[model samples]
Target: MNEREILTNYVYKMVASLMQNGVEDVVISPGSRSTPLAYAFASTKNISIYRQVDERSAAYFALGIAKAKAKPVVLLCTSGTAAANYYPAIVEAKYARVPLIVITADRPHELREVGAPQAINQISLYGERVKWSAEFPIPDDAPMTLPYVERHIARGVSIATTAPFGPVHFNVPFREPLLIDFQEELPKQTFRNSLVGQIAPSQQAKELLTAVINETQRGFIIVGELALGTDLQQMWAFIRKLKWPVLVESLSNLRTNVPEDCGQYIVSTYDALLKSSIFKQQVAADTVIRFGAQPVSKFLTNFLTETLPTNYIVIDEDPMFRDSAAVSTHFIHTAIGEWISELSIENTVFSEEYLLKWRTSEELAAKHIQSYQEIEQDEGAVVRFLIENLPDNSDLFVSSSMPIRDIDTFLLPTKKDIQVFANRGANGIDGVMSTAIGFSEARKEREMYLLIGDLAFLHDVNALIATRYQPCKLNIIVFNNDGGGIFSYLAQSTVKEYYEDLFGTPTALSFADVAQMYEMEYMGIEDFKEVNKIMEPQKNPLRLIEIFTDRQQNVASHRKLWQRIQQELEQ
Candidate 1:
């Protein structure tokens, strides 16, 4: 076996090991250095391969797949700047706890520091962004080479898919003559690996938590964005017995698919209810049990900080340091399943007066919100239209900044089945389109809709190129306010001189031309005329729906709604 044979066999072992470890998809960017692995991935029978022109978009695309499926997906790119392009998504994957198998094809050790083109020090390039990083030894025909490579792939997949899941890197260096003979038969290996994960609690811990729940007269369950496999039924069962309200965010994936018995006590309009400092103090809980990350609402943050609870327990399976509010009295390391079984077994459900207060507030606020029958101008109104129009079981990907803020404001936890997602880890605006495009690819049967702002839409406009090739349907509803709409809600909007130029950076590009360039169906909606019709899936895979809005009006509308709700609740 010579150099080509060594590279070919090594790539084959990697492909086989990855498949055995349950990796079904890999995203690849075109490059010469990565030809060997890319070829082998394409040739493999069980693996599905995706090709992207840009590395940045490709990485986010992989991140989206990993996030939606709650499984490890592979991202393969060439060395040099291509590997650098994956930095942003890797950072998001780390904090968001999404599993990604990052593989980069690098130049041989001899090529480094010798002024070789497309060659640089590729060792540990991603730094702390990845969970683990290792450089693959140069390909060899040694009898031991195949075994070590298989172990390497298995280790990478296991580490990535484990608790506190994140991206892991493996740099593969190859010499020249990387070509492989397609006619030759490849060796079939039987190597396989498996991993199972769950964080159960001690009996004593469960008893202590049960005592806390039973003793508290006033309490609330705070749930934010949780990873895959969170037992919502168990959570709701516990809440039903405790007779406490649950504040759920859109990213919690709890806005939909909720059991009606417990759904009656679920509070999704807390962002509005908590906005009033007076109400925040009035409805303060004596005990607060939080799960996953904090909800995307500053008012809710203020309520948690200003009205500190006596017994606040933060629960999560990941051991990473949380409790950003600094008010958590205890942190529990257990999933919702184990403890809920012990605590939610009460024969009679308590009818706490506190739950009545929450239900009343939620109803008043939601009624005021439903009064808005017109949405031709206001950006926030778009959220209401979406909540009302989007088909059941649809996937809604909200962009950071204004889009998610509005979603946190308008979305209600109910019996519908809408799943919401966002890049809230770094909270950056880049790659919004690409990530959703990847999601569309991941769940091809479900209809996908992206709620993005104008500024965020242009930031990753290159992702539109993917719409041409991706076989899934994507409906991008971009709120074209001509600039940063979120800044309009901040104090900086008071600054008239530099507001538009600095904080409110406007990009005046025609989205219709964008649709033309990408060859997508275009729809510019001014009003909610047959809004449900627009929400319906189309024959074309890609569609762009642009809504023109005034940033000032949008902010005013939000403030006005909050005030009206406050007045109604006060009355």
Candidate 2:
């Protein structure tokens, strides 16, 4: 085979291998260096390609797609800074345990450290943020590199999909004849499945569990972000039978029909919950049973560490904990589902006094919700409107800082099918809007609702630009509070002089102008009552609905809600 034929065959085989291995999506950022890989991926019918010009946005876009689909997604970018731009998403994938395959084209080894354009140490660009990294050396002769390139690509995919799955890097270096177009049929390669089998719990795990149940009167079960295929029903059944106070994070998949009166167990990741002395007291337990991934909020971690349980049993398929302060007394190395199944057969139950206290605390929280400004004609009200009006079967992607915090506290979705997503990996507000757009594109059939703050919405304004692919009907509701509304509730908001300059910096730009620039439909609402009226149904492209609120009032309203809840609890 000629040089062109070898390169073409290599690219075809790699793409084919990825598709066959269950990777269905690829986010490609256009550039000359990666032209061959991009063309090969695009021409392949089995894989879906999303075109994003900005590498940073493209990486996050791929992150969103992977996160939503619960599958490994590939990100294609050119060498140099274009590849470096994937660092943020890489860190997020590592921390959040999302599977991402990063593919970057590079210059041949001969050109390295010689000041060649777009050439830098491509190896380990992501440092320790990724699970694995490899440099595919260029062939001395084009034909020799084909098999090596094909093998490494397949290996990278496997490493990413394995347990405690995370992002993986593949740096492919090509020489002068980068543009290769050979129609020759490429031979396919099959990859060996190297699955990570779980180790059965040692005698120590069982002994530890027995000691905790014997010693502690009050035990709490807390579940965080679990993997997609997790058996939630089995776990829930175990907890319900025990009548234990179970605190569940939004992503835990355990936030189901557990009665509010069960206890002061359902913790909130919002401002009101943060200030609740009562809620804090309720969480002070003798023991805690932790399952799944880490919670997104810093407050929750602080609370867990400060109110240290005598024995904290952490159950996870992957034994690693991303949060530094999370110290486990007992680490069960088996799958959480398996552990719960075994525990359920034993028929364990907690003290009635312990269960009653939690139920009372939940009553306090419920009363608090009823007292909070009734979600009317303001920021709080807008959140309430969404909770009530969000269409059935719609997926909600909330922006960090304000939107997610609010939803976690106030807006509880009525339906279990309405999945909620956010960039809690890093909690950065930069690419939130764009990430939601990518999510909408990935799940093209379902309608997506994105709730964002004004500042976050403006950060990725360019993401709203048109693409060749048909735009997903993404309904975006922008809380136009004119600045970072969240800062007003934080301690930093007290610094009157620097508050607006640093934290609450308002852009003073109009969403209407942005809509015109992007050629998207726009709706502006001054009153919260108009939220439902404006957010009805829409077709194609994208729709932006802006709601205005007073920064001062939003803070006050949230405060009042907490106060009301406290009063109800006392009564």
Could you say which candidate leads in lDDT? Answer: 1
Per-residue CA lDDT of model 2 for 1-571, tens digit only, reads 6777666776777787677667899999888888778878878775788888878878888888888887899999888899988887788788777889999999888888899998888888898899899887663445556566666766777778766778999888877687768443435665544344544577677666756765667777777777645666677656655556676776664544444443234543333443566666765778887777666556667777878778888876676754457656777766655555454223244566766666666655755564454553467767766765666677888998878777777644233456677887677888787788877877877768899999888887756652435355688889988899988988998879888989889878668987776667788888655667655767435788888878999888877776766665555
The pairs that clash in candidate 2 are 262-359, 263-358, 263-359, 264-358, 264-362, 368-565, 375-381, 376-381
Q: Write the per-residue lDDT of candidate 1 for residues 447-566, one digit (tens) a residue.
A: 789999998898898886655555657899898888988888788888899888999888776599888887788888765464445665575678888987777888778888888888
Q: lDDT of all predictions, in order shown?
A: 0.82, 0.73
- Global local distance difference test of model 2: 0.73
Candidate 2: minimum summed lDDT over ten consecutive residues — where?
262-271
